[model samples]
Target: MDIAILVKLTSRAWSLNILASMNSGIPGRQAPLLAATSASRTAFAQSLDHLMQLGLLERNPGHGHPLRPEFRLTKTGAEIAQTATRIVQAVPDDTEFALLRRSWTAPILALTHRPQRFSALKSGLITISDRALSTSLQRLEDSAWIEREIDATLRHPFPTYRAVNQGFAVNQAIALVA
Candidate 1:
């Protein structure tokens, strides 16, 4: 599994909840899923749409909306859901990985395994906005997962960063997703 795919699966608050409902063998399609997850309609629908788009779910041709609709896991979806279930076991409320629920956090943390200047991280992550990158780095620093150091070698001094704890849990999560 690509780390990016895992990141998206974990990023949304209810994404895992929706997947867990489907994997739990509940019936009555979205109604049961919504009830089981207790998520608002908008969040439930959005998560369901994302799961379907990820190919983790497919509409059951046997049923359709208006009267009723059904969904089933694709083989790939089942595999991922099974893996996700295991990942879920390790995280209760998942506050342990709160940072990971944001898209930029994991990639930023992964790159911070080594000391890196802001420019190096921004260039390496390509497609991340300057504001977002700076924000993610600041959050990580605030979380005590990383810290800044003065880059005295520069003509004009600048700060570089390196992971402090490097978050063993996050590393384990990356392995699980893989």
Candidate 2:
């Protein structure tokens, strides 16, 4: 809630990415995580230490002579990680890459993991209004993450949406969020 805290959280490079990588159950050891995150060693160490200090992660200090210790999320960290997993990912939640950072983008993608029509999506999301869903779908289409299929069998042709193969990886990560 405070500006200082906001700045502090956003200041840590590759921090959120680490959480997402972990949340997807990638790895517990440093080397594997380093590879999974593709973060520079120095930056990864800094972010790992900061996350531990924030009570988000824990290291097995008593094991493996400390030099090659194991790490995992603390209870607090796991809880937060579950909640933030969608945004924290192998790909940073930057606006430049994908629209997943938009409020409903990930949720919409999650719902569209399989093909679905406009009405199904609106009803499934419940709180999303028609306009908001339309806008989110448009963004996904613009990014080429979702394909729009028109069905003319019905009196009025209706559009059904499905995610492209490339979108599946990110959508799966968000689905594993909790």
Worst 10 residues of 1 by lDDT: 166-175
Question: Cα RMSDs of all predictions?
Answer: 3.9, 8.9
What are the TM-scores, per candidate, against the unseen true structure?
0.67, 0.53
Model 1 error, position 4 (Å): 4.0
The lDDT values for all models are: 0.70, 0.69
Clashing pairs in 1: none
Q: 119 in model 2: Cα distance from truth in Å? A: 1.0
Q: For residues 1-178, what per-residue lDDT tens digits would candidate 1 score against the true structure?
A: 5656765675555666666656767763888888877778887788888888888888888686855678888888877776655544544555655565566766666566668899998987777789988998888888877788997886999999877664434445445655
- Candidate 1 scores a C-alpha RMSD against the true structure in Å of 3.9
